[model samples]
Target: MTKQITDDLAQALWETLLLHSTKGRLRYGDITAIACEFGLTTKAVTRVWKKGIRSMGDRVAAVVKAGWSRRGRKKSLQSQTRPRTTEDLIEESVMLEIMKCGGSNTYKIPHQHKDKLRNAGKLPTTLPCDVQA
Candidate 1:
């Protein structure tokens, strides 16, 4: 995997490239000059510059600029604000009932039930009894 670039450096290079392009179209030589001025190799600068330009073109620069600071905050807030659906509630209740039915202690049950379930094709693809209790 490629190493990540710092936001400050990326932003600076993005602005620099944009300025260059606005005044006159940027070329490989311009990129090389900027890389030299920034004490970075041409390839490294090109990688960052291209990434920044792509991010800008796709209109995701602002979100990337913000990093993961607001990562799960909006999701949590939205979840708290919205009411759970009836289906969600029912599914949760069913899950709770399954948990209370000694689902985790299946090893205590006789092997006959497992064999019957397997024979009748009622068991899931993977047998729960094969897993830890």
Candidate 2:
């Protein structure tokens, strides 16, 4: 006569069978061996195998359906937003500062423009003397 198994025991047995099948490529004989080791019958092991296979198939089918739905959906508007480039604004600011110091060749103004600007901390000390204007 077949013994009644608890739900928890059945679940544990099912997981063990799945793990063994994955690792060793189990057959019905292997399932029977595992069932015997776990104090279960071959018929019980067969039931667990069937349940595990069905559950795995259902999970795979659900995932594939989800992927198909996502493939058919349109992307949100937020995903189309593009960030503005700061390159143009930065270049313009630098050009304006250079023009404020007069033409680029005004480094010939001796120490008046370059050294004064450096001493007042307005210009970087590393500014090349040739480009100071």
Candidate 3:
């Protein structure tokens, strides 16, 4: 697996590359040299530069430019949050009951009961019981 670059190191590398590219477009040899210094592959350095820097066509770019989106799902507003469905509540209560009695085994919750639970979305998959019980 490739080693993950730390945010600080990446930022520093981006800044240094930006400084060098201010004169002219950075060459592959420059990226290779930086890669050697940082113990990263040249491809890794190029990828980082491409991701962090904007407009590869530009001869000069700033490393610390803003506007890159923060990734992942946006937070749902409190009003937009969904309430639990009836099936969800039932599944939760059943799981609590399972934990209370014993996991998947004790109190001998029947296969038919489990099947009913699965139908109601209380269980997602079959358990490892040898018999119906």
lDDT (Cα, tens digit) per residue for candidate 1, span 1-133: 2334567766776677777875435865888888777777777677766666667678774322424344564545655553433344344444554565656543332233544654576744332331222
What TM-score would each prediction reach against the true structure?
0.39, 0.39, 0.42
Predicted candidate 2 versus true structure: per-residue lDDT over 7-118, tens digit per residue: 6677677667766775535854788678778787887767766766776767742111111234556776986754343344444445555665785744332233544554
Off by over 4 Å in 1: 1-5, 23-25, 62-133
* Per-prediction backbone clash count: 0, 0, 0
Where does candidate 1 clash, by residue pair?
A: none
Give the clashing pairs for model 2: none
Each prediction's Cα lDDT score? 0.57, 0.58, 0.63
Q: Tens digit of lDDT per residue, candidate 3, span 40-118?
A: 8888788777865555456455453322345567878999764444454455555655766657645433234544664
Candidate order by TM-score, decreasing, is 3, 1, 2
Badly placed stretches (over 4 Å) of model 2 are 23-25, 60-133
Q: Name the candidate that leads on lDDT.
A: 3
